[model samples]
Target: MSTAAAELRSQRFAAAVPDLERIEAMPLLAEIDALKRARNAVVLAHNYQAPAIYHGVADFTGDSLALAQQAARSEADVIVVAGVQFMAETAKLLNPTRMVLISSLAAGCSLAESISAADVRALRRRHPGVPVVSYVNTSAAVKAESDICCTSANALRIVESLGVPKVIFLPDRYLGHHVQQ
Candidate 1:
């Protein structure tokens, strides 16, 4: 094996290799890449992924929020998120016009569990025309209704982007306070 492959194999994971190998598609990774290029889709993987899946992606890598923005700006007509559910949702939220698919639908976020569109609607009703700035950890339904989205890394910038002196931050309260700070 090459040195990089060896290093990846040595890394620890919660699932056993045999468990993943029963219907392994690693063999088709090259073919999948070729197919994606033919179809003009960009594949995104996250920073926390298993090395095999991470390295096999087509175009880019980052934290969930960054990958979402990448999907939004991509020239490709389709986006395949080789990551988790929340990541896929974020991508779809940003790329509402583009086709977005997930490698696995079971992946999710408990923090993302914190808010809903009804909540945003109610909040917007109370605030009344105040801009809603949703954290990127939210569901696409929530994001679709938001005026703008922000990552922890860029929350302040996003808030400032609205050119408004005040905004309502959502889903991740700590991120709200962090950005306010």
Candidate 2:
């Protein structure tokens, strides 16, 4: 990493430390506790989520997959994921019997949008019978419509594991381009 970027990150850490200490000494957490009980819901937040939302509201927090896995294991009737649409869809895909809600559908992800089911189907037509390996960052409708799901960290493994000569990866042109290389 560049020194500038490293310095900027260090500055961010320095800026956040004082506020974190203050929050730790406050009664805000108590209020959030009451809200959680009243809502009868559990928040599975992403690491990228705002500190107030992540630390204040989230009962379980982690990366996209980790939070989704937690949601699947949680007993809460209402699961509110303070992340993007794909993350929420992942929760729905896992816990199909439960209710899942995204804090903001507009909070989109480039990787998730890289491919759609329709795009996959269209590509399939072009390739005749080649398999389509979609990233888990897709809608359930897209997932249900897919051959299988994989993550960015596991994209190549899924490709090699599937043993398909032709592959059509979607929605995120960037992720697709990255995987192709």
Candidate 3:
């Protein structure tokens, strides 16, 4: 990294961290920067990530939908997602040619785990001809089974755009309800 860019990264980390933690985080942050440069990788952080990850090393940070959009548009050789598995999966789906990595294997989401591709297939069988509009929170398999994918922000619009009278929204019942309303 250039001197100016390194200084800017340090400033961001310093602003995001408490004075006591800044010293401890410096080495790790430096390591991450080195790895990013070596791999030509971009880090995408979710809104719920810690400030250090969000503002310190993340090249881009936003909600799931925005991160997905960023992943689709990214020219980086590798993408590191500081979010749940589904988010990483979405990034991979969007950028099939890029190497996508998750920060932690243990990271999971209850909403994404709530349904499976098999469940979606069954739903399709039960409600034939009804288009399935899956939330972006679903796994890649579930998304593949879905007729279309929509984020919470665009669920209603996507459903309406389909021009279908009824659509099956998956995983998040609350978001489905909100879209229905």
Candidate 4:
């Protein structure tokens, strides 16, 4: 690697995980970069992903909505999501024609696990006629059940945009509380 690239890698590791050895990451990063180019893929990483993946290999990195928007806008034939399962599913939902893959199939999140489509269906049963605004942190099934999708940044706007007195916001208690407030 060039001196500048090495320095940048070291800085990224330092910023994300201070104890991570820079030398331990070079080979992996090289392989990942080569794979991305070979597959004509763009890596979209979430802000919470490892710094090496986020800053080193990812073509785009940001919060959930930003990553989803980027995935939707990407022209790449393949998309690699370097976050949790829900993120990968979101990318696939947006880019139906693109090949979307997650870095790890086992990766999951608390927010994603907290709710299900059955739960959402029950909510619909209870609230008859109320629109459901699902947070993007949810699973594809949950999102499919939603009337619309919203990110934490736009939850309130989405709820209000429905032009209804109430909307069922799911999966994320913190974001739901914030939106309610």
Ranking of predictions according to lDDT? 3, 4, 1, 2
Error of 4 at 138 (Å): 0.7
In order, what lDDT does every prediction score? Answer: 0.75, 0.74, 0.89, 0.84
Structural similarity to truth (TM-score) of each candidate: 0.69, 0.75, 0.91, 0.85
Q: On TM-score, who's better, 2 or 4?
A: 4
Q: Whose lDDT is higher: candidate 2's or candidate 4's?
A: 4
Predicted structure 3: lDDT? 0.89
Candidate 3 TM-score versus the reference: 0.91
Tell me which residue pairs clash in candidate 1: none
> Total clashing residue pairs per candidate?
0, 7, 0, 0
Model 3, range 73-139, lDDT digits (tens) per residue?
8989999999999999999988988899999988889989999999999999999999999988889
**53, model 3: CA deviation in Å?**
1.7
Give lDDT tens digits, candidate 4, residues 1-181. 3467657755766677545555677788788777877888888888888666776777778887888889989989999998999989988988898899998989999888999999999999999999998888899999888899887777888898889878888878788889888
Model 2 TM-score on a 0 to 1 scale: 0.75
Candidate of highest lDDT: 3
Best by TM-score: 3
Root-mean-square deviation of each candidate, in angstroms? 5.4, 7.8, 1.9, 3.2
**Model 4 segments more than 4 A misplaced:** 1-20
lDDT of 1 by residue, 1-181 (tens): 2456434533422133344742364557556767776888777888877665665443677888678778878878889887778788777767788889998788777777688888899999999889999887888788877898877877888897888877989988888888788
Candidate 2 vs 3: which has more lDDT: 3
Q: Residue 8, candidate 3: how far off, in angstroms?
A: 4.8
- Give the C-alpha miss distance for residue 175 in model 2, angstroms: 4.8
